[model samples]
Target: MSTLSFLLLFLSTFAFIAGGSAAKSWALSDNNWGLLVLTLALYSAGNLIMLRLVRDLGMGVALSLSGFVQLLAVNVVAFFIFGESIAPLHAAGLVLGIVAVALMTYPV
Candidate 1:
């Protein structure tokens, strides 16, 4: 991919994962409604950017790659930033998910 496309994809992925983190952190309804709304808005914006990036690429490749990017980003943030731990099984599951995405998206 070109540098611009790569940058756009990275930005889209970062925004989406960050928004999810915010939503998870502010799960309380009454107190965190504003946060939830903000996160949702960010997510919507990220999705729009992602859609444009995907259009520049292709749906099958873009979505399949994005699925893996989203999964890795969320897990990495959850583990390192949030001080969360995953069991070995979950790690294996993540690997399996990546493999699945690669398989499903491969130009056959």
Candidate 2:
């Protein structure tokens, strides 16, 4: 991938993490309108970046890479930033996800 595509993917991953965090907070709280709004905006931005990624890299590669990145990023944020627990199963799942992404993106 080009430098620009890498940057866009990074930004998109960050947006997914931010949006998921906000959504988690909103769900935990009784009512957090600010978080709700922030989540929506972040998710929208992430989607826009994802569109660009699909355009640049094609749907299969872009979606696979982005989905794995987002999954890992959100899990890390949930565990470290939000003090959520990560069980052994969750760790295994993450490892499997990484492996899957690697296989999917490997050059033919």
Candidate 3:
């Protein structure tokens, strides 16, 4: 990937992570119906950004890298911000996910 495309992908990934973090906050609201709407809006923006990045970079690289970035972001947020714990199984799953991304994104 070109440097500019890589930078865009990185920024898109960060936006996705930020949007997802904001989305998770909606779960705490008592009026749960609005939560779904708000979360969708946030996620949609993230997806749009991701789509643009993918267009610039190509699907295999964009998606695989984004997937790993997002997974790590979610895990960190879940553990630190949300006070959630990852069991051994969850950690194993994360490792597997990372491996899959690596394999898929590797140059042929």
Candidate 4:
């Protein structure tokens, strides 16, 4: 993928991550309407950027890379921001997900 594509993907990924954070906050704060709106807006913007990415990098490759990156990022948000813990099994699963991404994205 091109550098531009990478940058776009990262932006969209962060958007999605922020949306997730907003969603969690919304739930925690008794379903705040503003946070819910922010969550939807972030996810929508992320998807729009992702649609551009599909043009730049093929859907399969783009989503595979994006999904893997999101998986790792969400874990970080879950841990540090949410004060969550990771078990050994979950770590193993994350490693396996990394392997799956590598296999999925390798040049044909």
Candidate 5:
């Protein structure tokens, strides 16, 4: 993958992860419409960037790669930022998921 594509995808995924965090905050708060709005806006921006990603890389590759990025990033954020933990068995499954994504996204 091109470095540009990787950077753009990372930016898009960061927006999505921020949106997810905003949504979680909204859920924890009481009637915080601002957080909800922010979530929607971030998601919209991420999707907008995704259009470019899909155009540069095909649909399958773009989404598959993005999914892989999201899988790793979201978990890291959830674990460290949100103080979440996964069971040992599930951690093994996460490793498997990483391998699966690596296989899917490997150069053909």
Candidate 6:
């Protein structure tokens, strides 16, 4: 994929994950209408970006790459930003995920 498309995908994945986190927070709270709205907007924007990425990279590759990126990025955010612990098993799974993405995305 072109650098522009990759960057857009990265941003889209980030927004999507962040929106999920916000939605989780809202769900755990009594009232947080702002957060709910923010989540909806962010998810919508991310989906739009993902659609553009699909056009550029094809649905299979684009969605796969975005899913992998979102998985890793959300975990990293949870670990560092949310003070969540990463157990050894989780670390191993992350490594495996990276290897899988590498194999899947390697130039044919």
> What overall lDDT goes with each candidate model?
0.83, 0.90, 0.76, 0.93, 0.93, 0.86
| Per-prediction TM-score to the true structure, in the order listed | 0.85, 0.90, 0.80, 0.91, 0.91, 0.82
**lDDT, candidate 1, 1-108, per-residue tens:** 788778888888988988988887787455687788889987998899888877888887788778878887888898888888879998899899988987886777
Clashes of 4: 0
User: What shift in Å separates residue 17 of candidate 6 from its native position after superposition?
Assistant: 2.9
Order the candidate numbers by lDDT, best to worst: 5, 4, 2, 6, 1, 3
Candidate 2 residue pairs in backbone clash:
none
Clash count list over all predictions: 0, 0, 0, 0, 0, 0
- lDDT of model number 1: 0.83
lDDT of 5 by residue, 2-38 (tens): 9989899999999999998998889889979999999
Q: What is the lDDT of candidate 4?
A: 0.93
lDDT of 2 at 108: 98
RMSD (Å) per prediction: 2.0, 1.3, 2.2, 1.3, 1.3, 1.9
Give the lDDT of residue 58 in candidate 1.
85
Query: TM-score of predicted model 6?
Result: 0.82
On a 0 to 1 TM-score scale, where does candidate 5 land against the true structure?
0.91
